[model samples]
Target: MRHRRPEDRRPPWGVRRTVFSGLVPLVVLFGWFTLAIRLGLPSAEPVGFLPFVFVAFAALVGFGRWLARAGILLALLGLLPVLAVLLGGWTATGDEILLSRGKPVVVLVSAESAHRLKAGLAYTYDVRNPDGSTDSLEPGVGTRLPVGSQVTVVEDPDRLVAPQLAGRQDPAVPLVFACLGTASLVAVVVSTAVAGERRRVRNATTR
Candidate 1:
């Protein structure tokens, strides 16, 4: 039996390496997503898909055996929220742009009902359109107004997107989702790389 070198015997998933691998990707992703939001980019799907691609590449290159499997699982689970963030961002951005070009009509919409979802509380509203037509609208999450309370909202003339509450276009929701999704992907990459490095070192020592 060949004796393993000191370097090879050291823990591959050391605190420093784990933290470095996790944080670097997270910081980079945060910056990228923030920039995309500022620039009014329709979606961040390309960057969001990077973790999956990286996992596939790692598998091809014979990295960590467990990495490929775990990475794929993590990436898939993370992808849902990432896709949601992008889609919601795209819709919100489009609504803002459209409303900017045209005059937004302010209307008083009464809360029809409120219900709790697994994600959060959601509100349904009874809206009277400028065209004198009545419609029921369920604006996805984040309203605290009591039922029957008349809330002011800017009606989209084209109805391409859901009516947004007046003076309430917040980017915080998307940012939160972006962070969560990115962190999941980062964990996969970092763990996989560390495992692969340890395997390589062990193989070299045994030879």
Candidate 2:
């Protein structure tokens, strides 16, 4: 009937350790992504970030035994944002295809504004078309232009999509999201496999 020491009673994987294990990989991934974008690297697609994802998963598997279940859950949750971004990109692509058949128009930027997004700053311009019609155009994230600047854009004849900047259809933003989503799926699969193998080994040892 000896009393157990407090340290001995504590679980091997404490709350702080679990949190650190989970957050370290995420922080590292965020830093790498930001650096890639700043350096103008080819990070617009899922393939570009595959190496980083592999490293992240490796770290989790090697160092975070308790994190496998959490990783699977987080990975599943991550798919929501990926789906939303892909849906938006699909709609935009369809609009662009429709606008391509229409004539190009030169629009004057009447006003300019900047907004802060999660990734970075995005610019919006109030553009005046030749027909005296005005519309707001987003040139994309990290783009900036002075007011009164003239830009060429393809206008949709059926108004299916808003006027889009000509020669500026960069899929970087959407593809980045796709990369993250793919990484999450990979994490789920790897974590599940690791967990199952570990459980099988423990069962064999106990028997």
Q: State the lDDT of candidate 1 residue by residue for 135-155, as single tens digits.
A: 555556785655444556655
> Per-residue lDDT of 10-110 in model 2, one digit per residue for the tens?
75543445445545655654554454333322112223344544554554444334445444454445445334334334434434454457568899999
State in Å the error of residue 98, model 2: 4.8
Off by over 4 Å in 2: 1-88, 91-99, 170-207
lDDT of 1: 0.52
Tell me each candidate's RMSD, in Å, in order: 10.1, 13.6
Task: Kindly report the root-mean-square deviation of model 2 from the true structure over all alpha carbons.
Answer: 13.6
Alpha-carbon deviation at 163 in model 2, angstroms: 1.8
Error of 1 at 24 (Å): 18
**lDDT at 53 for candidate 1?**
40
Give the TM-scores of the predictions, in the order they appear.
0.43, 0.44
Error of 2 at 96 (Å): 4.1
Weakest ten-residue segment in model 1 by summed lDDT: 40-49
